[model samples]
Every structure is written in structure tokens, then in C-alpha cells.
Target: MTELLPAAGLTLADEILLAERLNEFVQDREAFSDNTWKQLLSVMRTGSRWASEHGRSFLPMSRADLRDYLLWLQASGRASSTVSTHAALISMLHRNAGLVPPNISPLVFRAVKKINRTAVISGERAGQAIPFRIGDLLRLDAQWSGSGRLQQVRDLAFLHVAYATLLRVSELGRLRVRDISRTADGRIVLDVAWTKTIVMTGGLIKALSDLSSQRLTEWITLSGLIAEPDAFLFGPVHRSNRATVALLNPLSTRALEDIFARAWREAGPGKDARPNKNRYRGWSGHSTRVGAAIDMALKKYSTAQIMQEGTWKKPETVMRYIRHVDAHAGAMVDLMDKYASS
Candidate 1:
């Protein structure tokens, strides 16, 4: 194994020391968020399997092997962005281990570039969540009012706040009772202390609509989380064991996604409003955020206004949602009739 060392003059003992330093650096660095950490681990697992099969260590894998891995990923039908992310992750891991990443190789870089160009030319777009429109919210609200169950009340509050605020599921899960305040106008305002975008700018304020405020008040009165300022705003409800409903367990992002899915199924169109029978398929936690952005676009709001409301720093990112709506109802379409008749 000593003969396999690269000609870079790194001794076996120096390699061990490098590994130790990397581990220490990882420990001291701020941790990635839960979802991001999970994604990184998944990418690592795939890369590990490839390295093992090729009888090579990830830290010292050859450029050819990395290029092959990217080709394999593309062949396996991974989205272009996902393939790019896997490449980026491999590069980061190699750098962390104090070695040159294979992605810098011309072969690997050209492979990535070719794949990206192919995706663009083929008109391949990333899959988007089916946004929950304002009408869907009204229907869900009606259903919750008739149910009158503790879980129903909680779901109502969550949906109302989530849609109105357009918060990501992770942010919604992190909401605390103390972060909420009532404005003099009777609206509920959320003091978002942390967000993916606001990590540097500190925090921002989001004012909930009147309907959301009413639902939140009802949820608080029923769930009894109002008494504990530190309690999670959207905690779990033990429907099976009613005694545990008072326990303030923070809901996971997956759980929040489930809530969204179930609500979407119940409120969407279909016979008896059953899951999978509705028009609202492919909806997820991001649906509300997408829907809100499109709604603003339909109301003729400018790009800047939509970006600020959605907390999107990138105009291109915000444009994706606007583009989806524009494809059907943009001003260009409205002008077609005038030109066609001439």
C-alpha cells in the first residue's frame, strides 16, 4: 500500500495527521441543516460504493473514475442539477480530505458541461411541486370547520399560516411560540429569527392574514401550547393517545410534508375527495410557496415585489414561478388577438 502513494510527497504519517485535522475541522464547523446533511450522506454512500467496486479510496480516486461516475449518474436518469450536485459533493469531500478533487480534471469538467448542454437542448426542466391555490385553501378551511377534531384544528392553523407566510417546511417546523406576536390591528406577525436567506441579515417580520390569525387563535386555545412560550408553534398531536396532545414535540420536516399531502388530498377535486383521485398530484411542502408567487404574478405585481415577498434573493429563481404562470396568461398572449386579426 505504501507503493500506491501519489508522487506528491505525502508520507503515511502525514496522511494520518491530515485525516485527524479534517475530522477536527468538521467537528468545529457549523453543522449543515438536517435535510442538507442527509443529502450529503446519501451522496457519500453512492460514491463509497463506486470507490469500493473500483478498488480505490474516494480520497485518491483517479480523474477517469470520477468522469465514469458522472456518466453513470447521467445514464441512471438523475436530473442534471442532481448530477451537478453529486459532482460538487465529491469535490468538497476530496478537498476536506486534503486531496485534489477529480472534478477539476478536464474529462470530468467536460462531461458535466456536455450533460448540462444536453439537458438544456432537450428542454428538460426540474419537476416542480403542484402549488396549492387560494381556492384550495378555502376548500380546506371549509373541511376543517366541519370536522371539529383537535387534529383538524391544528391542520387548519398550519395550512393557513404556511400558505399566507409562504414559509418552507423547515422554517415552519422551527417556529416557536415566543416568535409570534399580535399587532394592534389584530393580525398575527411572525418574527422569523432565522431563515435560509436571513442568516446574515438577522431576521424579518411576516404578518399573517386575518384568517390565519383566527385559526391560530383557535389552535392555541385548544392545544394549550399558548402557556409555553418556548413550545414549538406547530407541535405534534397524539390523536391515538389524547393524553399526549399537550406534549410539545417539534414536528419533523417529513411530518410537515405529510400534513400538506393529506390536506391537499382531502381538499382537491375527485369523487369523495380521495388521495390520488384529485387534480392536485405531485404537491408537496413547497406547493404553498410556489402558489403564492404565482398568485402575486397574476395580480400584476412587479418582479421586485414578488422577490421581496418570497424572500428570494435571486431574480431568476423567482422568475421560474412567474414563468409558469406567464406561459398561460402573460401579456404577450393577450396581444396575440390584436395582431392575428390584422
Candidate 2:
């Protein structure tokens, strides 16, 4: 469950080997439910893909091939922030392997800059997209309105908890009934055990609105899971009497993406408005997080406060969520109000 930095004494090959071992550790734990191993595998596969074409016979990689690989990632639709994470993984692999020389030189620095710039330009700086918005939620609720009471309640609960908590899809999917609790002031708070940036310490968030909480309560009561606090909150709702264990697993990443796609289709202008295969699209699963941040920013939440609430470790992380359109609109309103005739 804990993320470890690469060891100092490791070589490039050793780093790769250790990464594989760590992945096995994660798979064996079974305590965690997210796709940590899958994401790490993705990074390793990316390294392999580039290393195949760009690596020298004796060297783990070539500078020119590295540059070209970065360019390929950028053009192939990897986000700037994600690309940077991948770059960090790669750089760590090298540095931990003692690939760099002790004496710094301009040439070495420039080569480092080349790789870093590739990450920056790949949309790595843009960070992850936020979750869905209110408008999008309404559209989704409407789309699945006729399914049934349980399905309706479940859909609303998914959207509400996700947006209200700004939870990653894995956290949302893995949520248990006991994970949520009420504070002294009657405000709802969530005790998120696992997230992208956490190992143990939990964060708190005040109730932004009441509708989400109500939907959550309704889903719990209606789903007959109040007795099974430790069990998955969302799971197969319409299973037959003899359904197997494998048939009723909680939501998967692809399922969540498909849900987002359906909502987006209805929210957008046409069938082509479907949000997929792109990071910074008109909408996606993370749009809820993005929309929540935008909502907070418009309400005058400082970047520092926003970062804390969003559980981001850095201010630049918060900046990445502040989309250009929102920035321009805020600036425009300020200017128009200041210069307008009384």
C-alpha cells in the first residue's frame, strides 16, 4: 500500500527488477483494491516501448531517443502531468541506477532539460482532470431514470459521493459503508483509507451540499447493505438467487469510464461529443474533480486551501486544475466590473 522511491544502490536493470517485485508485493497484499500494480505496469511498459527503439547496446537509453519518445508521448495524447510522472519514474530509474556522472556539466543539464521539457509539453503540467459536474450529473440521472429504484439510487450515490469527496475512481469504487461518518456539527465527513497520495493519514471535508448525502443514505438503506458495513457499498444489484461470487464484483475502471461516457453523450451537442480517448476533453470521469475545484476557485478558495482540500501536495498541482477558460472568465468579470460606468 505504501509507495517507495527507487533505492540508491540499484542499477537500471535492478530498478526494473525491483519494480516488478514491488508489483508482486502489491498483488499479493489483497488488502488494497485499486489499480496500483496496473498503473506501475503501464509505466514500465512505456519504458520498454521507448527503450526498444531508443536504447543503445550498452546504455539503458539514448538522449536522442529519449527526446523522440517524449515527443511521441505528447503527440499520442498523454497529459502533461501524467507524462511528467512517467518521466519522474524514468529519471528515478536512471538516477537510482547511478547513470548520471558526479560532475555536472552544461551538456548533461541540457539533456536533462530535453527530457523534462518533453514531459512539460506532453500536458504533464496540466495534472489530472477533475470529476463530473452538476450539469453532467443531472443528465446522467435523467438517462438512467427508468431503470428501477435501486439502480436510480445507486447511480446518484456514485456521482454524489465522487463529486462531493473529489475521490479517485478507485476510492469511489472501493468505498465501504463504514468509511463515511458524521461530525459533531452534523456535517458529513469521509475517512478515506487509500488514495493516490496517502498511505495512512486521513483527510476531512465539510458537507458542500445536502443532496449528495441524502442520496448516499438512500442508496445504503435501499440496497439492504446497512448490515454489511464492511462489504462493498456498490455492487451487482440484480443478481439471481444463485449468482456466483465472481459475478458480483464492485465497479471497475472501464465500467466507470463507460458511465461517464454515457452521461457525457447526453450532456454534449452530438454523438461525436462522446468523451473518450482524450484527457482534456469536454467531459470525463475526472470532470467531477475538475468541476469541484473550479467551483471552489470561483467561491474564492485560495490555492493553498484548495490544495489541502483536494489532497494535492503542491500549489502547482492546484494551478493545473485552474483551466484557462475559467481564469479568463474571472479576469473578464473583474475588468468589466472595475471599468464599467456607475
Candidate 3:
């Protein structure tokens, strides 16, 4: 590991002190989830590569070096959020290396602020997944429910459970056969034992709708996952339409996104009473979560209830999904609907 900064002024004793800090950073990484560790390493390599491009090394990077790196990212058309993540991760690396974090500087802060403002002014907003509302689910269920390929049936079930529980794609892919249980009266209850939000606490149990349970049962029966309770619930549906226990590994997050997008698009446009409001494009696994929250809002469910169901840690996050709906139902909209129409 290269020194984070010039060690010219430090004595040998100071080097020993710094070694302790470096050890702490190294040991702490051992506890990160595999996905997290991969991300951190990737970012670190990217930062180093960017530094090499400018004829410098990343470890001893200064605040100015970081600001330049961020500017380069902006110039290369990275999203503001991506720029923010890079800046944050680079800063954390610096801190853990016993150097001052570049993000602590006013210059670095101004650079990030500029990137954010530029994105907003240029309409370079991050695209949110089109909400997969209950109506879309109905249409998709209609289209994909019958004697389809093993993959198609699995996806139908995936979309249903995803919308009902608002589970992130990672959580959905992490689901195990053991996580599912049926009540004596035949109601299906899913125990979500692995979610990013509730990592510190134990998992929560979510109830599936009768329709969703039926779809899932079909997939489980088709895939033959019932025999292996310890295996992951979902796997790649091969060309032969068989997903045996031997073929069991959790679906990759990208694979899950592609699966959701496929089913959502294949179902075609939904039929809503509202004109020009059909959402049939650009759906992702996240659409299920967003759609679930929006549906709950339309049904007049409280924010707390929505958050509880979605396992969202922040009120502001879940509200961002339904704020447009709130705007539409405002007092002015009421006036426009009742008086202006007449």
C-alpha cells in the first residue's frame, strides 16, 4: 500500500502509528458483504486509473486532484449520482488511509454542487423505473400466466411478489426456498431474511396475495425448487425450461432487471380509464417497488404504512415516488376538475 500522503515530516514512530490505522481499514473490509467489497475494489481501481490518466497516483491524491477527477467524470457524461458516489468513496479511502478526506474541502464541495446544478438545469435527471402498478400486474398476469416457458412463469411470480413486498432486486434474488411458508388455511407467507435495508436487524415476513401465491406455486412446481428448501428460490431458466436444484444459484441483479423488463414489456400497454397514462415502457425490477408504493398511495394508505411495507428507511425516499400523485390531487386540481371543467 502506497503512503496516502508525503511522509517526509513523519518520524519512524509516526509511520508505526499510521500502520495501525491502515490495519484497521484492511480488517474492517473483511466484514463487508461480498457485493460491497466488489464495489469498493472496483471504485478504487477506477480512481487509480483516472489518476494515471493525468500522470498521478490516486493514493496520495489531494483535494485539487479529487476535484479534477470529478470534473473529468462530469465531462465524460457520468450521472451526478455516479459522480457523488465516486467522490464519497474516494474520500472514505483517504480517511481510512490516515489522510484528510478531499470532500471536507470547500473546493471539492463546490465542484460537486456545480455538477448537481448542471444536471438539474440540463434536465439530465436520473431515470426512475415506470411504476409497475396493480393494473400492469393484472395485464401481465393475463398475458404471461398460461402455459408459458419455465422462465416466463418464474418472472410472472417474481413481478407479483416484488410488487406486493416492494423488495429490491437484490433481496428478491437472495430469497431461498426456506424463506417461503404456507399457513394451515393455505395463505402464503414469505420470510424476507435478506434485505439491504434491514441488515442489522432480522428479516421481516410479508404475506403474498392469493393470486401472487398461485403464480409462485406454479413457478416452484415447474422449477422443482420445492425439493431443495436450502437452495435459492429463483435461478436461471435454461433453454430446456428446467431449473433443477443442481442449477440453483441466485439470479444476478442484472439478470433480474432484464427479467422484469422483459415481462413488463411483453405484457403490452395496460388499459387504464385515464387517457394518455399508459405505462408500458422502460420498466425494471425497481418498477415493482415504485409501483407498489404508488398503488398504496392511490388507495390512501399512510406514508408510515407504505414505508413499513417497502422497508424504506427514509420517509423522503418513498415520498419521492408518489409526490407527483400528491401534486395531481392538490386543492388547485380539485378546483380545475370541478369548476373549470363546467
Candidate 4:
């Protein structure tokens, strides 16, 4: 099941071919859970590049070599989490090929531990995306009125959906017109077909607010996506404001990020304010997700509720998103403030 792919000679097309082969293999055996072959290939390329530079082979990777690769990744200034992801990807590829991953062995596992310890000692924390919370949405809603431009309207709807569903970028991109529906009780439900963590068999459903429902309806009507049930929910509007590029073509990840940034920038009444400008620049695809989770925490929502809303598998992962708020807003801090006042 192992692939002895050329270390240095692998190119972009080769990566694609290998990924496709792996995908076909997955279809037959159902051995791997990940459907994100492109992301896997991207990680594979990093290992391949390193292997090429070091005159080493990546596919039939030795445990010692894998350990060194992790160390090299950290030494080259990659973040601790990022280094772990690199190692994890390699492990995934090995598992996909029915081989035991080197990462599980003490030889390579110790390297990962050391990397984590180093980061902790250096006070290096994993960076969370800048959240676009309820406040940001309200400001945008107040200032970004009117649906004269379809893209403007669509972007607003997109932002609302992102916040309400707490969906990852891939989930957001995969949304189709048919996925949004109104229940008999007038509740808007957005059905998530699959997620990064688990395959929902098209059963995972999320509730969107009436506010979000209205924005979505407006966008659907203006963009005429309702007529095409299978069309991408968030298609790009061309520059002329004439029409979308194509109904079937989904917006690329970069395009989605750009739309978010543009919407964020134009949300402010000033439109030229330094704060808004910086937020637009700093925000990423996960900003709304981080923002929504933090907003829930501030509202005293339980970690369990937040996990269900965001489709997170682990409480620790959810905590990571809202930990900064928790770090400052604990009961101890409130009592300390009360003591100061007394």
C-alpha cells in the first residue's frame, strides 16, 4: 500500500495525481476519513520539498527522519501547532497507505512533545482569528443598507450565515440553495451536508436567526440563485454589478476572504477609519467563527452549547476559541474588582 514517490521530482501536477490515486483507493477501501485531498497534497508538498533539499525520501519515511523533519519545521520558524499539523499530515498519509505512522512511535512522538515544550517556554500561543461578533454585524447592518448591488446584498447574507452557523469556510462554500429551508414553525434551518470532522450524511442542521433568514432571502431573490437549487449559495458578482460569473461556479476561498474583508471595511460609517481598515486587513475566513464563539461566551452561553453550535468535536478546541475572553472575565476577576471598589 506504500507509495515510493520521488522525493524531489514531485511537482504540482504529480501531487494532484497522487491525491487522486489515494482518493480512488479511499473509495474502494473506505480506509481514510478525510476527503480533503487538496489540503493533504499541500502538506505532502512541504515534506517533499524538505526531502528534496535534504536528499531524503518522504514516502518511505523513517522514524528518525520524521523526527528530524518536525524539529526542522520548528527551527525554520513555523509555529508549534503548524509543526504538529505537518507531522500529523504525514501520519495521515501513512495511515491512508495502510502503514503505521511514525508519529505514533516514541522516537517521533518525543520530537513533537519537545516542540510543544519549546513553544510553551517561549510564551508562544496559537493565534486565533479576529472575531467579527454581534457588534460588528450590527454596525454593518446599520451602515450597509440597501440591496441596489447584488454582491453587496449577497456579501451581507454570507456574513450573517457565517456568524449564525459558525461554519468553516469549506462548509460555507459548499452551501447550496436547497440547503436553506423554513420549517413549519417559521424557523430557518440550514442543513450541513458534511463537515471537516464528521460526515453528517446530509443530516446536520443549524438554525439561523430571522434576521439572517431575511438577508438570505434578499440575496437569493436578487441573485436568482433560488431558481437554481444546486447552484453555489455564494457565487461571485462580477465588477459591472451586472450578474454573477456563473451559477454553477462556487466562489474560491480567496474570493470569499476578499468579500469578507470588503464587507468589513465598508461596514463602518466612516469607511476610512483606521480601526475598520485594520480589521478588514487582519480578518480571515475564520474571523466570523471566532467572533461568534466569543460572543456566545460573553453572553454566558455554556461551552457545550457553543460546541453544538459550531460543530466542534472537543471542548478544548471550543475553549481555544473563547479562552482569551475566559482568561480575563473569570469570577475571580469580578471578585477582585469588587474588593477594589469596597
Candidate with top TM-score is 1
| Per-residue lDDT over 43-87 for candidate 3, one digit per residue giving the tens place of the 0 to 100 score | 888888988878865765777888999999999988898899888
The Cα local distance difference test for each model comes to: 0.77, 0.60, 0.80, 0.78
lDDT of 4 by residue, 206-267 (tens): 88888888888888888777787888888878777754635565788888998777865666
The total number of steric clashes, by the backbone 3 Å criterion, in model 3 comes to 0
Model 1 over residues 1-342: C-alpha lDDT tens digits?
112334145788868866785696478446556666567788889988977986766656678888888887888887799999999888766666666678888998899999999988987776666777888888889879645577788888998888888888888888888888999998899988767676655587899988889998888777787876888888877866231332355687778888887886687653433333233465588889998888988888999998888788899988877686668665787689679888
Compute the lDDT of residue 128 as modeled in candidate 1: 65
- The C-alpha TM-scores of every prediction are 0.86, 0.68, 0.84, 0.82
Ranked candidates (lDDT, high to low): 3, 4, 1, 2
Candidate 2 stretches greater than 4 Å from native: 1-37, 53-83, 95-131, 135-147, 183-188, 201-208, 239-249, 265-282, 325-342
- What is the C-alpha lDDT profile of model 2 across 116-185, one tens digit per residue? 6776665444335434656666676666544555655676677777777777777677766677677675
In model 3, where do residues sit more than 4 Å from their true spots?
1-27, 33-35, 246-248, 270-281, 331-342
lDDT of 2: 0.60
Q: How many backbone clashes does candidate 4 have?
A: 0
Give candidate 3's error at residue 304 in angstroms.
Answer: 2.0
Worst 10 residues of 1 by lDDT: 270-279
